[model samples]
Target chain A: MDYTDYYKLTCSEIQKLYRENKASPEQVVDSYLKRIEAVDGKLNAFVKLNRESIDKQLKDLKEKKEKPLYGIPVVIKDNICVRDEETTCASAILKGFKPPYDAAVIERLREAGAILLGKANMDEFAFGSSCETSCYGPTKNPWDLDRIPGGSSGGSAAAVSADEACLGLGSDTGGSIRQPAALCGVVGLKPTYGRVSRYGLIAFASSLDQIGPITKDVRDAALLLNVIGGHDPRDSTSVNAPKPDYTKSLINDIKGLKVAVPKEYFVGGIDKEVSLYIGEAIKTLGSLGAKIGEVSLPHTDYAVSAYYIIAPAEASSNLARFDGVQYGLRSKAAKDSLLEMYNRTRAEGFGSEAKRRVILGTYVLSSGYYDAYYLKALKVRTKIKEDLEAVFKEYDCIVTPTSPTPAFKIGEKKEDPLSMYLSDIFTIPVNLAGIPAISVPCGFTKNGLPVGLQILGKPFDEETLFKAAYAYEQNTEWHKRRPSL
Target chain B: MVSKDNNNKKSEIDVGYVAKLARLALTADEIKRLGKQLNDILGYIGKLNNVDTAKVQPTSHVLPLKNVERTDKVVPSLRIEETLKNAPLKENSFFKVPKVIE
Candidate 1:
């Protein structure tokens, strides 16, 4: 296999190569380093590359016998804690905050012999839909430098798409991972909430958060999911359940499966190209002997509204810890009063988006308006979850265009927060309902940007979702096309 | 548009009250800005009133979790110095802050 292809090979292929001695751990690591050196400047995908430490780990792994992920290199979002590396979360406030301990997921990845490549840039506190909020600046799309890679996982997706890293770990809240993956033309999965441990992910909205894999193909996503998805005693919210064999079901045929296409998803404002490509994929599934039907998630229109309230409300609480007291950056000067110091520290530390949300969240959750806003949104959220549960009972899977449109220019929606929130309209409800959803590249737009078809499955049924997505991928040539990086 | 009655204090939630409850000491200009922004956002959210939610019970959490009881065992924590290393000001294993009650 070509050494460049070593960086793009499927997880299973890499494992086979390592087992058969056709490739060694050091060679695989070396291949990715050279690729990063050669191409990363143009892509701007990585915020930090720990070449020396990762090489040391690879040398140690090579000395030992074969292990799971023995030679595989994986990149992590900058927000997720990896000991000794700066976990900036792409914010100036956290510029030099090196974590002293590994996040729960990082420990697992390290134990599995996976090489920690580096930290990928993200939206500050994983807040923005586009990666433009980063203190380092926006991560440009590898396919077209002028366009943006969908964010807050944009760097993670861009790195994988540009072949700078084999696979990347990203946190998804309100479609952060899947939307960017769709926009960047890669596979991104938001595992069922609580399916993966959230002990180390810097909080965006604690309730909606999940750590998942972004990769080039479905099976690698499944394999990474298998490695990362499991309960941790440290995380109180983790689900105590056995992990299913995610890779075993990827090859299963989708004949006679019931797929639901919600009518509300096909409404106005969805780009014509996205709708057309997703419609073609649906028709292709129908031709392959699967039963397709129209279903209504009537409460979906309220999803974006409900998401903003709950996510920010939870965010305001989760972020209160960074009060210039316990961790992260602190203000420099002393003040006469504690309150004045608090305000000054916060005003200087947090970015614009973070401050705006904190103010809104605090207002909504305050004494008088708690029942009017936060409580009411939570009630609406219940109905939204119920709506999906009702539909899932009748259909095995739900399909929709992953994003309303293709990757937009970097600064297009930055000024208008409402418009930016609408970008994740289709993907937010899945996170709200805590279901497994994956974004797979379906087709390219007229401008040559990738459009994705989102496939959502019942809770913990990632196996079935992967089978259908893999089947759809097999019928089309979209996954074979690579960005001319 | 709904008319404001002399006794319509319930419908007219003042920004000052909201700010005070939120512990935000806003200036006149800040309050005006927040007032307009909140009104616009609240108007958009007001659309939810059109739905027939009278019969529905309020739902707080999506997952049907109950008794998420942990073992209550103490796990090892990061070294106090390491954890507090990022603090802006610290002394004697505690985060240093100005006196609150003096």
Candidate 2:
């Protein structure tokens, strides 16, 4: 096979080539490096490329036991640490801070002999939904360069969609993984909150953050998840539940499965075309012998509100470790006092959105106002979780649009923080409820931009989502469509 | 604390004070811009006030498990060189920081 064609293959497909003796691991890695060089300048998907590290990985693979992701190239979000490599969550404050240890997923990937592709850019500290807040600059959508690939996992989604890598690792705090997958025409899954370890994922809203797979299709998503999902004693929050072989759940049968369409997700602000596609998707599911009905999650309207408070509060606390003492950038003006050093280092290092969120988080958690804001948001979070629990008790899964709109212009919502916040509305509730959700391409708008259909399931029940998503995906051509790049 | 504006809406939040608490120093221009932005966002967040969560227990974590314990055994830790590899300013084996004492 030609080296140019290597970038188009999925994880399993690449493994097949190896079995056929048509391609070697080094050849595959070289193909991706060449492809990235040819296109990454335009997409800016990568913050840093592990050009030298690949040779070492390839050399190490020669001695490791064959595993699921062997020789498969995977794009990792910049926030996930890779030993001796810079893991700066696209924040200027963390510039030049290389971790001494690999991420949990990275360790798993290495154990499986997968190539460490490169670090994808992200919204600085995962604050923005547009990915424009990245200090390394925004990653362009593969579908349309002028538009944003939905973020804060924008780069991860775009990298996978463009076939820059077979799969990408993205952490979803709100809609980071799925929204970008929706906009970029890929499949992204945010596994049940504790299904995958967050041991090495740079914290952003810890209660909501979960690392998962972004891939070209549902099967690949499952294939990658099988390698990464499991209990890790390192991450106490990671569930100790039995790990299922996710690929076994990719049956093309959702017959008699109960799916609920949350009425609130479609009522207001959703793009007409996006809804039209999702409507067609619902009909497709019904035609596939699945039972479908409308259900109301009354707390849906307040998801974004509660999220802004809760996520920022967690972020403010998680990000406090970035002071100049340990690593990253230290303010040059930090000469007189420790407080002054901290103030100036953060002031100079943090971007506008980061500063806004830190302030907002501080305001909510501050004395005399904690009850009115922070505690209130936590209570609201309980209500949101209950809403999902109630629906899941009667329904097998819930379906909705991954995002309210398709890819919007890059600069369109960057200035308006509220508008930017609303982009993740449909995806935020899943995080608040701590459930699993997958975004698969349902169809594209008339403008050629892809719209995603989000399938959410009960906590620790990603298998059902894969089953349902696979059934729908097998019957649609949406996931097969690639950008003309 | 929120202060009522002329319209009787809680609109004024001291953005500068909030930034100080956050350990972020902002310029006057940033304070004004981010201040209005914060108020607009806070007004949006105010929607949560309508939910009757008075009787509801806050679900801080999604998992039901607690005290996720592991064996309290000592293991190899990062070497001093590796630990201090990222320090922007460092002494022999320690991170050098600004003097906290006056």
Candidate 3:
């Protein structure tokens, strides 16, 4: 049997191989490394590989093979810090910056014996959805190389979809995780706000970002979540909620579960085929003994506007730290007014999109515009969240098309940023509402692009999302279909 | 000249002034291109004013905010060298910047 086929094995299947002594950790890691070398040139999924640390991590795992993820190789989005590793967030400004300490999730993953791969590419500071904003280049969809793997977690999703890694950890501010996961034909879970610690994640939006799992299957997502979820004393915003054994939620029974199809999600501009696929997926939920019906999130249209304002406002403040000061790139300026040093350094470091967000954020939060734009957006955020909460009160979870359209051509929306922003119309509200949403492979388009079924649950109730997603995934053949790379 | 906009009108939102506030040295071409793009986005963000948020409390954090208190005891931290390792320029334990005082 070819070792290449080993790349196709899901996380649990690989673990089963380990249990049966059919393959060793060295063989598994070698297969994945080889697969990455063969395909990553086309996909551009990873920014840096921790090749130097692999042998050491594998050797260390032997000492504690009892760990849950012992020897499991996981790719992380570039934004998440790994101790002494370059975490550039695919931005030139942060290039060559090696963090002194590991993020909280990295600590947990290491303790659980997960082998960390090199960091995945992302939209520079996670500012864009198509992954094109990265200085590292865009991650091509494994399904269709000419198209984008939806981002800013595009690289993580593409890596998992293309079987370059057993699993991936991606931070979602809006639809970064789930959108890419859907487009790449994998499972992407965005846990509730503060559900996962953000200590090591390079902040895109303080209130919006949450680190979650992107994997080949639902159970792997739940497995990784169980390992990373729960409180961290290091992160003040980390929720004190009890972390449940998410694997238990994989029960095939969604029987009697109440699911709502939000009317706002099904509105115009959504691709016809995408809507049809989501409808069929909802029917699959009903066939599995779950009750599915339509509900309305009235202020849904205002979500993207609110998000554009709020995220950038927070981003402007959060990114003020990147003034070529303590770390990362420092430009050469002969005349040193200190202020000129800052302006020159920043001018050279940040990409166009980063600069755009910072400037927009500054504009909105500026004294004259603060109450009108920034504060009003915050109020609209309340309205959007209330819309979802009102629906959750009557439903177990909400289901919709993860993205308005499937994977699109690389330069398709690049000409118009507003149109590109609209691609996230469905997924953005979930982030603003700060709820848990999982994107699972529902079906494919006529052009063979995968459709994502977004299942959103009330805050911290990831169990319901897993149960419904798992049931749908188990009953369908969509998740099993691999992209012919 | 940019004026304080009481209404969410496209009140000459100066990308140049805002760029200065953001501490970015954007080129003239960038300022022009980014100005147009930002105005286009701001036009869309104008939708927020349509929502009657008359009495609604704004949600800054999705989760309720609470101060996390800890004992003031000092804990072990990164050594000075380790802390300064990532600094682009440093002298001794302090970060080195260009002359701040004229």
Candidate 4:
């Protein structure tokens, strides 16, 4: 088989090739490296390519016994640490910072025989909805080079969509993974919060952030999640629950499954084309014997507002550790006074969006305002969670459009922060509710940009989400369509 | 309590104060621009006020587990040299910082 054909193979297919001795892990890594070198210049998908580490992993594979994900190449979001590799979180503040230890997910991937391909770019500190805020310039959508790939996990999504790597791991805090996966035309899943360990994921929102897989198709998402989604002692919030073999949920049968289409999600401001695709997807699911009904999640209007408050408030506290004394970029201009040094180091290191969120977070959590803002947001968050739980009582899964629209032009929403925040409106509620959600390509717009159908399930019931998503995916040709780069 | 109408005025001063608390130095232009952006975002989030959460408990975490403590055992951890390797300025296994309490 040609090396070019290797780039097009899914994780399962690659494993099959390895079993047959048709391709070596070295050749697969070389093919992807060459593809990244050829196409990443245009897509800007990868922030730092770990060439030496990848070569070392390839050599190490010769001594390892057969394992799941054997010989498959995987890309990790820049925020997730890999020992001795630069995990910048796509921020200038964390530039040149190499972690001394590997993230829990990285350890799992290595144990499963997956080679680390590279670190993909992202919104600095995962603060923005679009990839445009990266210290490394924005990653372009593979389908339409001029459009922005939906983000903070945009680079990971773009890399998987462009086949720069077989599978990409992305941390979704308020739709970072799913939104970009929607825009980039790939499968992105956010496991139930705490389902996957957050040991080395650079904190964006500790309660909300989840590391999941971005892949060319749903089965690959399941395969990658099977390896990475489990309990870890390092993350205190890691759920001490039995980890199931996610691959078993890939059965393409959704007969008699109850699916809910939330009326609030489709009400207004959604692009006509996106709504049309979602409508078609719903009908297709119904055709497959899944009973679909309209349900109302009344507090959906408050989800975005609540998410912004909670995520940033957590971010403010989490990001405090980035003070120059410990690690990362430090400002040389404030050598006069310690206070001046602390101030200058942070201001110079962080980007505009990071600064904005920190200020907002600090203000909301400040004295006298805590009740009206931070505390109130938390209360509203409970209401949103209740809303989803009520629907899930009768429905196995809730489906919605992953994003309001298809990929917009790169600079379209950069100037308007509120508009940019709206990009994650559909995906944010799942995070605020801390439920499992997966975004799968449903259809394309007239301009050929992909539209995502989001399937959300009860917490720790990712098996149900995989079942629903896999059924719909098998019935459609959307997942097979690749972006012509 | 900052009123909704006075929120914009409060934001002007609040942005500066919050930046100070965050230990982030902001130039006059950045402060001015960020003040407006923060105000805009805060105003949008003001929609959360509509919900009546008098009976609802604040959810710090969705999971049922509490106080996930491990056994107090000494384990092999990162070496001191490895821990300080990423520090921008270091002095013999210690992170170097600007002089304080001078």
Candidate 5:
């Protein structure tokens, strides 16, 4: 196989190559490093590349192939902490900040022999829908330099797309992981909220954030999921459920599987091209012997609104620690009162998007408005969850266009926060409901940008999701297409 | 007919009050900018009131999951010095904070 093709090869294939002596772990890491050296300048996907750590991992893997993920290289969103590595979340506030220890997920990945590539750029504090808010320049879509790679996992998705990395770990609060995976034409899986540990991820929206995988294919996503998903005492929210063999069921045929297409997802506001592609995917599944039905998630229309209120409310609280004296950037010359020092420090440290959300969040959570906004949004959020439960009872899985549109020009929605949030309209409901969801490259728009079909399942039912997504992937050529970087 | 107005905005809200609640010490320009932004976002959110939610049960969480309790046993962790070393400011093994009051 061509060297570039090795970049797209799944974890299963890479492991086989290692077992058969056709490739060594060192070669895999070296190949990816060379690719990053070649293309990362154009993409700006990575903010830090820990070549030394990765080289040490490769050497250890060669000495003993003891771990499940031995020698597999993975990229991480800048928000997820890896000890001694710069975990900036692409915010100037955290310019040189390094965590003292690994995030729970990183610990798991390390135990499994996965080589940590480096921190990928993200929207500052993972607060924005587009990666443009990153302190490091925005990660451009590898497929089209002028267009964006959807974010806040845009850098992770872009790196995976450009052959800089084979697999990536991303934090999804709202649609950060899935949206970028769709735009970049890679696969990203957002496990149910507590399925993966969140111990050391820089908080964006604590209730909504889940650490997930961004990989080149479904099984690769599954393998990474197995390595990362589990309970950790360090993370109070981590689920206590037993782990399942996600890869063991990927080849299961999705025949006779009941997939629900919500009417709200297909309403007029969805992009014409994206809707057409998803409609075709539904038909393709039908042809492949899957049962497709129209199911109503009536409260779906309220997803984005509820998300804005709840996510920001939590974010406002979670970010209070970044006050000058604790960690990250502090204003050196502020001679005013202590409060002034705090404000000035934050003002200097955070990007525009982070400040915008902080202001909005504080407003919503204020004493007088709390009941009307924050509490009310929470109640609506409960209804959204109930709505999903009512629908899941009648279907084996749910399907929708992962995003409203394909990749747009880099700065298209930079100034329009509402428009940017709308791009995640379809994907947010899954997070709100705490259900497992995956975005797979189903097709491309006429402009040649990729479109993703979202597959959602009840909590812990990732096996069914993998089965359906794998079946669809096997029948389509979309996943086979590489960005002409 | 007796009823309570759910849409009433608390009448005491002023620029400084809102700014304080938002952790912002605003300049004249910021106060104006925020007043307008808050009003606009609030107006947009007010649209949620149009839904006939009288009989609808307010939903707060997605899962019916009650909080699971773990035994309150402590596990050994990394050394305090190691964990606190990266704090921007630290004194006596605790993260130092700015004094808010005399």
Candidate 6:
């Protein structure tokens, strides 16, 4: 088979090939490595390529053929640790840090025989909306080299979109997975909070972070999710709920599905073209016999505000572990004083966005101001969750544009922090509500950039999300389109 | 509606004091740049004050789980050498920090 054909095969397709003995895992890995070498210089998607480790894993996998993800090469976000590999979260602080243990998802993928392709780049510590904030430099959107693939999961999405890997695992704090998937023209799912374990994921915001799949298509997303989703005793926040066979939910029928389009999401500030695409997508779903109507999420406007407060406050606490004393970069200038060492190491270690968030987080959670900022944000968060819960009682799913606009130019929003935060406006509320959501390519703009139509379902009801998303995907050709890079 | 005075006062965040609390040493330039950026973000988030959250409870975790605990039992931990492997400075199997007292 041609190398391009090999690289283009989905996870299940590759698994079928492996089962038939028509393709060896070594051949698949070789094709991907060659593709990454030829394309990554222009895409900058991967931070560290696992050529030697993949070879070793391929040799071991030749002996076992029963696993579901056998011989499928998968890219992982930098934040998800793959034991003994450099697991830097694209930050200078963790430049050479190699985790001694694998993340729970990585462990599951290995047990299922998925070969680790490499670690993809991300915004430093998952702090930015674009992958441009990485210490290693920006990951350009494969669709257009001058634009950004929405981030902090940009590399993972871009890799899947560009066929650099069959699938990718990325952590979503606030639209980190879904937004990037939208821009990169791939399918990305942020599973319900706690539906997937967070054992070894480098924490961004403890309550909001969930590692999920970015895949070439919806079926692959479900297939990957089947392997990675379940309860783990190690992650206390992990829900002790029954895991469903996600692939069974990938039926193409949404005959009686109820999908709501929140009026607030379509209000001012949305790009006209994006709104048009999403409107057409709603019509398409309606044409497919799904009940679609406009619903009101009264507190939708406050979601971004509440997320900024809550996520950063949690981040300030979670990131306190990186003090240069253990497991990361330490400053040489503070040899004489521990206080200086702590301050200098952090100041020099973190990037601008990380620093901005840390400072904002500290201020919000500080004495006297806690009740006003941090506590108030939490109250608003509860209100936002309540708003969604009330809507869910009457609607099975909510549909909206994944991003207000398509992928922006690389440096467009980098200097403007507020504008950068707005990129996640449509996707942030799902995280705040702790529900499952998927971003599937719905259409493209006149500039040839892709737009994603987001499908959000109730907490732990990813099956419903998959059903609805799969229905829309099967009826459209958007998911089949690939960038020319 | 919430009073504008409260929102205005809240937006006047002290970047220097916040940086001190965060244990981050910033240059004068960064402080100036970050101050403007933080104020801009705070101004946007200030819209939350418009909502009447007087009776709302703050949600720390979305799930209802609380006090998750495991049985109190001893378990093997990272070996001493392994634990000390990533430490930037160490002495006699212990992480070494700068001297704190004379």
DockQ of each: 0.40, 0.68, 0.71, 0.71, 0.38, 0.71
Query: Model 5 Cα displacement at A384 (Å)?
Result: 1.4
lDDT of 3 by residue, A38-71 (tens): 9999999999999999999988887767778877
How would you class the docking of model 6?
medium
- Candidate 5 lDDT over B1-102, as tens digits, reads 000146455222255565465555456766666556545555555655554555566555444558767798888778988777667778897977667686
Per-residue lDDT tens digits for candidate 4, residues A1-485, read 79766898898888888788888887888889889988999999999888778778877887664788888889999999999999899888889999999999999999989989889999999988789999999999999999999898999999999989999999999999999999999999999999999998989899899999999999999999899988899999999899999999989899999999999998889999999999999999999999999999999999989998899899999999888988898998988788999899898999988988888888888887788788888999899999999999999999999999999998998989999998889999999888999999999998999999999999999999999999999999999989888
Candidate 1 ranges with C-alpha deviation above 4 Å: A2-5, B1-39
Per-residue lDDT tens digits for candidate 6, residues A252-292, read 89998999989999989899999999999999999999998
DockQ of 6: 0.71
Model 5 regions lying over 4 Å from their true place: A2-5, A62-64, B1-16, B25-38, B55-60, B63-67, B72-74, B90-101
Q: What are the clashing pairs of model 4?
A: none
Counted clashes in each candidate structure? 0, 0, 0, 0, 2, 0
lDDT of 1 by residue, B4-100 (tens): 2213232433666654434444567656765666555555665555556656777666567777787778888888889887777789999888778
TM-score of each: 0.94, 0.98, 0.98, 0.98, 0.94, 0.98
Isolated chain A TM-score, each model:
0.97, 0.99, 0.99, 0.99, 0.98, 0.99
Worst 10 residues of 1 chain B by lDDT: B1-10
Candidates 1 and 3 compared: the better one by DockQ is: 3
RMSD (CA, Å), each prediction:
2.8, 1.6, 1.5, 1.6, 2.8, 1.4
Over 4 Å off, model 3: B1-9
DockQ of 3: 0.71
User: lDDT by residue for model 2 over A1-485, one digit each (tens)?
Assistant: 68767988888788888888788888888888888888889899999999878888888888653678878999999999999898999999999989999889899988988899899989998888878999999999988899998899999998899888988999999989999999999999999988999988899888999999999999999999998999898898988899999889988988899999999998878899999999999999999999998998999999999999999999999889988889999999978899999999999899999998888888888887788888888899999898899999899999999998999998998889998999899999999989999999999888899999999999889999999999999999998899988
Error of 2 at A151 (Å): 0.3
